[model samples]
Target chain A: MMRLVLGLVVGVMMIGQVAQAQNQPLRLEITEGVIEPLPFAVPNFVPANAAAAELSSDLARVVAADLIGTGLFREIPSSAYISQITDFGAPVQFADWKAINAQALVTGSISVSGNRVTVGFRVWDVFSDKEMKPGLQFSGTKEGWRRMAHKVADAVYSRITGEGGYFDSRVVFVSESGPKNQRRKRLAIMDYDGANVQYLTDSSAIVLAPRFSPTGDRVLYTSYESGFPRIYVLDVGKVQRRVLESQEGTMSFAPRFSPDGQKVVYSLSQGGNTDLYLMTISNGQSKRLTSTPSIETAPSFSPDGSQIVFESDRSGSPQIYVMATSGGEAKRISFGNGRYGTPVWSPRGDMIAFTKQNKGRFHIGVMRANGSEERLLTASFLDEGPTWSPNGRVIMFMRETQGASGRSSLYSVDISGRNLRPVQTPDGGSDPAWSPLQK
Target chain B: MNLVSKLIAGCALMALAACNNPTDGTDGGPIDPNAGTTSPGLIGDQTSPSYFQQAIGDRVLFTVDQSTINSEAQSILQAQANWLLANTDYNATIEGHADEQGTREYNLALGARRANAAREFLISKGIAGNRLKTVSYGKERPIEICSEESCYAKNRRAVTVLLGGLAG
Candidate 1:
C-alpha cells in the first residue's frame, strides 16, 4: 500500500511538471535585435453585390500593399491559403491558417450602391483562435473605395499591433513628365497607394518642393510663375493660391507649415547667402531665424512645434541641425560620415528622416532626434525626399534609377528599414508629401 | 618717383592723342556697312558692328550658396559689355543655373538671382534693359553631370543665349 501511494504521488508530480513545461508561454523568445516583420494574411474581400467584385479585389490589394509597405507586416500570399472566406462574419478556420503558417488573418467584404461604397473587415489571431477585435466598417463615395479600404486596413493594423494606422492618409507629390533636361513638373495629390491622382497646378511654370500642411488642407510650395523663387500657399479644396510673402530679389524655398498651421518655416537666400526664416501666415510678418551664412534649408517642425530641424553646410559638409523654434544657437545632431540633406522630422517625433550622400551614392536614412543610432535604410545612385506615413511607421520617398536611363519612382520602407517596394504610378514620380490621416 | 611720373604722363598724352585722332577713323563707322555681305541681313553678317558693339559674356559663376557676383565676375562683365556693344541688334536671354548640391526650389531662386545679377551688370554697361531677357534653369541644365567640384563649377554659371542678332 505504501509503495502504491508513493508511486501515485510521484506520477502526479511528474504530470504536473509536464503540464507546466507545455504551458510555459510557448517560449516566444522574440529577439529584440532581429526586427522580424510580423506575418499576416490578407485574403480577397467578398463583394456584397456582383457589381462590386472588381472593387472588392482592388480594395483588398491596396490594403495589403499598404500594410506590407510598412515593413512591419509580411503579407502571406493568398495562394498559400487552403480555404476561402465567403463571409467576414463567419468563423475563421484557425487550423487552415495555422497550416499555412499565417499568424494573423484579415477578411473583409465590400458593398457598392450607386456612388457609395461600404466596407467591413475583421482581424483575427489564428494562434489564439479568436477575433482580435470587433468588426470595423466604413462608407464613402465609390471614388473613395480605396480610402475606405485603407481605413479598414488601418483599423485592423491598429487593433492587432496596438499602434496607429497610416493607410487612410494621402500623398502629395511632384509629378514629372517630358524629357530629363526640360522635365515638366506639377504638384499632384493622390491616395496613399498612388490612386485618384489630381494635378494641383499646371506646368505653366516650374514648381518645386510641395509640402502639405499638418491638417492636409493646405500646401506650401515655391513657384517660378512670378519669375522668381517665392513661397505660395494653396488651399487644397479651392485650389486657389496666394503668395505667402513676396520679397523681391531674395529667394525663398523649402517651406514647411508649422504643426499648428500658424506659421511657415523656410529658407531664404539674400546677397548670395541662404538662411532660415519663420513667417506668420496671418500677419505676413517674418523673422530671420538663422543668421548664419551657411546654406540652411529644408526646415521641418517637430511634432510638437517646439523645435525645428534643418540641413546646413555650416559644418563644412551638409549636416542636420536642430534649434528651438524661437531661434538660438543651433546644435548639430548628425555625426554621420556623409552629407545629409532634407532632414524631415518624423510625425512620431522620435526620429528624423534624411537623405544621405556618401561615396558617390545616395541613401535614405533615419536617426534619433538627438542624432544617434543612424541607420541607412536604402542606398542607391540617387534616393531622396523621404516623406513619413501619418503613423510614422513607414517612409515614402523618391528613388531614381541609375545612369542616363534613370527614371524616378516612389518607394516606401518601414522604420525598421525593411520591406522596401516601389509604389505604382502612371508615370515617374518624386517629392512625396504624405498627408494626415482622414478622420 | 620722377621717372615713374614722367612715364605715366607720356602714356596719358598718347592716350589723349589716340582719343582725339579723327583721322584714325576707328571711332565711328557704318553700323551695317557690310549688311549686303550677309544673307538678307535680317540674319546679319556673322560679324557685324552696331550701336551695342559688344558680346555680353554669356556665362557667370556663383560661389556655393551665393548668387552675388564677385570681382572676377565684374571683370568678365567688362568684356561681356564689349561683345554686347558689337551685337547691339541682338537680344539675349540670360539663363541661370546651379549645382545639384542644393534644394531644387532654392536652386531655382538662386539661379534667378544669379541671372538677374548678370542682367543688371549688362544694363550698367550701357545695354538696353529691354534687349536682355532673363530665365533661370536652376539646377536643371548641368553642363557637367558629375557630382564633383569640377563639374559643379561649370554648373553654377549663368549663360547668355544670343537671340535675333543684328538685323540689317
Candidate 2:
C-alpha cells in the first residue's frame, strides 16, 4: 500500500511540473517584431475652476492624441467609459475599465491659480489592478500648459512602452511654394504636432534640406544665395546665421552635423565631380573624406559616431553604403531591388531609415544595420528624406504628388508599418528633420 | 552641293556690287547678298545678333551614374557651333539642370558637368572662351512636371540664355 501511494504521488508530481513549465509566462523580448497596440481610456480631466474647464478639455484631448499617435496605444472612446474620473488621487476602479475592455486607464485633474497652472495625473494597469507609474504632477505658467501636458504624456508613454518618448519634440523642414520649375523654399520650424510654426528664412533664395542640431536650438541647411550651393548654420532662437565654409570653385550641399555638434559633414562638387567632405565648425577646416569619382552624398553619422551611412553610386547605381567615420572602404548595405538613398541612422542605433525606389514607387523603409530584414513603411509616387522620432519607433518623411498640380506634404509612420497619416503644415513642406525631445 | 553652288554665285555678285559701291550701301542695305542665300539660316540668323542669342539645341542627358557628355551630345554641339558662328556678338550663360533622380549635391555636380560639356563644346567650336558662363541649378528646377522617365528626359538639359545683345 505504501509503494502504491508513493508511485501515484510521484506520477502526479511529474504531471504537475510539466503543466507548470507550460504555464510559465513567456519572457518579453523587445525587438523588431509586431507589437499589438495597447488599448487604453482617457476620461475627460476635471477642472478646478470654470475658466480652466476649456483648457483642461483641450489639454486632455491633446494628451490622448499624442499617446495614440505613437502607435503603441489605442485610445478608447470616452462614450464607452463605464464610469467617470472624478478624482485623480482616488483609487482606480479596475472593474470599471476592465468591463469596458480597457487594459489601461488615465485620469487627471487640472488646477489654475493666478498665472500658474498645475496638472496631476496617474496611469493604471487595469488588468494588473496596480498603478503602472507613480502619480505625476506638473506645474508651470499658464502659457506653458500645453507643454506640461505633452511631458505627462511622454512620461506615461515611456512607462508603458519601455521606450523613450518623442511627443515633446519639434520638426524643422523646408516649406515650399510656387511652381515646380520656380520653387521658393524657406526654412520653417514647428511643434511636433505641426502647431506653433515659425519661418526662419525668407523664400528669396532657394533652400534644400534643413537639419537640427542635437540641442534643437540650431539648424544647418544648404542654400543657393551666393550664386552657388553652400551650407549655412542658423541659430533658431536668435535668428542669426552664418555660412559654414564656402570654398570657391566647389559647390556644397546636404549638410548634417556630427553627433557631438562639433563638425558638419556635407558633399562638395568640384571639377564636375562630387565627394564627401567634413568641416570643423570651430576652425572651418574642411577635409575630404571620400575621393572617389563616383557620386557620394547624404552622409549621416551613426549614433556612437563610429560609422557613417551615406548614398553612393560606386555600385553603378544609387545605394546606401556604410563606412567607418574615419573613412575607409565602404560596404554596400542596400542589396534589395531598386535604389536607396538618404539613410538616417536611428537614435536607438539598431536600424537605418531610408527612401527606397523600386518598381517606379518610392517607399520609406527600415533595415537592420547589416542590411537585413528590410521593411517598407510607406509608399507613394515620391516619398523621400526620412527622419526618425527620438524613440526610433516612428519615421517622418515627405510625400510628393505627381503631375502638374503636384504638392509635397509631411507624413509619419510607425516602424511596424502602421498609422500612416499626414502631419498638418501651414504650407507645403518637405525634408522634415525631427529634433530630439527638448529638455 | 547645288545649294552651295548657288550660294557661291550669289556671293560673287554681292562682292561685285560691294566693289562698285563700297561706302553708300554698306551702312543700310544688304551689302553681302550671300547672307540671304539660305532662307532657314536667314530667319534664324536674324533673330540672334550674336552667338548669345543663337539657340543651338545644345542639351545632354546623363546616364544613371554618369556626368560625362556622350557622343550624342557632341552632335548637338556641332550644330550649336554653326549657329554661334553665324551670330558672333552674343555672350551665353549655360544653365545646367538635372532630373529629380539623384541626391541634391550629386545632381548639382551632374548639372555642372552638363553645362561644362556644352561650354567646352562651344569653345572647341571656336567660340570665345570668355563669352560663356555656366551655372547649375542641380535638381531644383524641372521643365517637365511628371515623375516618370519622359519628364526626366526633358529635365536633364543645359540651356544657353543670352546675357547681352549682339555686337554690331
Candidate 3:
C-alpha cells in the first residue's frame, strides 16, 4: 500500500505558474442543466527526437480524447489553431486562442530513449492568459504511454475543475456470448475508456459480478464451475484464482470486499433461505451478519468501513437496507414505489447507487445515504449491477435489451444523469466493477 | 382429472413400448426381434427414466417470482414422489431456474427457494431427505428464450434430474 506514495514521486519540477490569470482560472461545474462544453485545444506534443515523433502525436491524441470524452470539455480542432508549440518552454499566445473561443489549452513534449519515455506538460488558461497550475513531468516505460497520456489529462482536469480525475482507472466486468438461453460468460477486464481488454477467465463456466478490491490488486467474483454457485478470489496480476467459500451443500455468491480489503461480505444460501455473511480474508473464518428467511445479498461497505449497505427482501420485496459493520438490526433505506436491489455505497460515502424495478421497467438510480433525494439516472428494459467510479462522480452499470435476441452492454452516466455513454467491450458485457485510479 | 388419466395411460403405454418395437403391431415396418429401445433396467421392473420424465412429469412450473407450489404443480410433484418412492435405487438433484426478469442475485436466491420447495415436498411424501439435492442456476439457464409469458412461465421451473442408481 505504501507503494502508492512512492509512485507519486515522479520528480515533479515545482515550476510555479509561468504567468498569472487576472481573473479566476477556467472552471466548470458538474450540473444537470444544459451546459455549453468548454472548448480546449491540444496540438501535437513537441517530439524531442526522431524516434519520439510518432509517440508525441499519439500522446497528444490520447490526452485530448480523455478530456473530450468527459462531455464537460470539447476539443478545439488543430485546424483552428493559430499558433503551434515548437518548444516545451514556449509561452502560449492567448490572444490567438481567444479569437477561436478556446477556453483552455494543453501543451506537452515527449522524449524516448530505448524503452523509457519522459513527458512534460502544462495546462494554460486561455481566457485568463496564464498557466493554471505548476508544470509537471512524468516518466514511464514506452509500453505505458497511454497511461502517461491519461495522467496528463487527469492533471489538466483536476487543475481546472478542482476535483479528482478518473481517467487512469480500469473496470472489471463479465463478458458474454451465445444466446439468451445458453449464454457463456467469462470474467473480463478493460480500461476505464474501454481499451486494452484482457480476459481473466475462460467461458468454461458462468462467472458473474466481478468486483475489484479497494487496492486494485485482486478481484472477487462468483463462478459456477463446480456444479454449484461459489465465490472465488483471483489475483489480477498473476491471473490465478481460488475458491473463497467451498463449503459443500451450501452455496455462496454476490461477494464484495470491505473498504480496507481485509474482509468480504456476501450472501450464503442454506436450506431454502439466504443470508448475508462476513468473512475475514486472511483466515477464511466467516460470521453470519444477518439471520433471516429472506434473500439478502449485494453487500457493499461504506468508504470509512463502519457500515454496510445491502439489499434484502424482509419487507416482502427486495429493498435497500443499511446495517452496522459488525452486524445487527438493519434500517430500511428505500421508501420508493419500486423494488430496489444491488445497493452499492458510493466511494464518497455520500450516496448509494442501485438497481430498481417499477412497473416492469428496470432503472439505475442513486440516493443519499439516508435514502433521501432519490434520483433515477437511467431506465431501460434491464439495468442492474452498478459500480461507482473512484471519485464517486460517475457510475458505470449494465443494461440489457429485450426479447429472444436480448444482449447486454456496459454503460456509464455522471451523477448529474448526463453523458450517458456506452462503454464498448470486445463482446457483450455486464456487471461492471470500476477500479480505483491506478498508481 | 383428464390430464392425470391421460398421463397415467401414456405412462403405461410408454413403459410397454420401451420393451417392444413401436409401430411393429400387425402390418408395420420390419420387426427386428432385438430392435427395442434401451431397457428400463428398473430394479423392481417399473417405469423408465424417460417415462418418468415425459409421462410422469419430472418438472414443476413456478409463476413469476413466487416459489409456492400451485395445485397443478402439487399434482405433478405428487406423481414424481410416487415414482421416486417405488424406485429406491436413484437419488435426484433438483435444479431450480428463474426467468430473466429480475436482478441476477435475487433471481438466484429465488431459484434456490424454488428447488428447496420442491425438495421439501418430495421429503414430505416419504422420499428420504438425503436422496434429494438442490442447485439453482438463477436466470443463467433458461429452458425457454422468449421474453413473453409463454416462455417465461416455462423458464421459471424446478426440474428433477435423477442420479442413476445412487440412493438406497
Model 2 error, position A396 (Å): 0.8
Models sorted by TM-score, best on top: 3, 2, 1
DockQ metric, candidate 2:
0.35
Model 3's DockQ? 0.63
Candidate 3 or 2, higher DockQ: 3
Predicted structure 1: clash tally:
15
Each model's DockQ score:
0.13, 0.35, 0.63
Q: Alpha-carbon error at A17 in model 1, in Å? A: 30
- Which residue runs of candidate 2 sit more than 4 Å off their true CA positions? A1-35, B1-54, B61-66, B70-72, B78-92, B103-106, B123-133, B164-168
- The runs of at least 3 residues in candidate 1 whose Cα sits more than 4 Å from the true structure, single-residue gaps closed, are A1-37, A49-54, A77-80, B1-56, B61-75, B82-95, B101-137, B143-153, B160-168
Cα lDDT of model 1 by residue, A309-380, tens digit: 998878777789999999998999998687888999999899999999887788899999999999999988
* Total clashing pairs for each candidate: 15, 4, 0
Worst ten in a row by lDDT for model 3 chain B: B26-35
RMSD of each candidate?
12.5, 12.4, 5.9
lDDT of 3 by residue, A1-439 (tens): 1121112323333433446557676888766688888899998999989889989889999999888888889998999888888877656778899998889889888888998787888888888877775667788888878888888999998887788999989999999998887788999888898998999999998899998999998999999899789999999999999999988888899999998899999999888789999999999999999999889988999999999999998999999999999999999999999899999999889999999999989999999999999999999989999999888888999999999899999999988888899998999999999999998
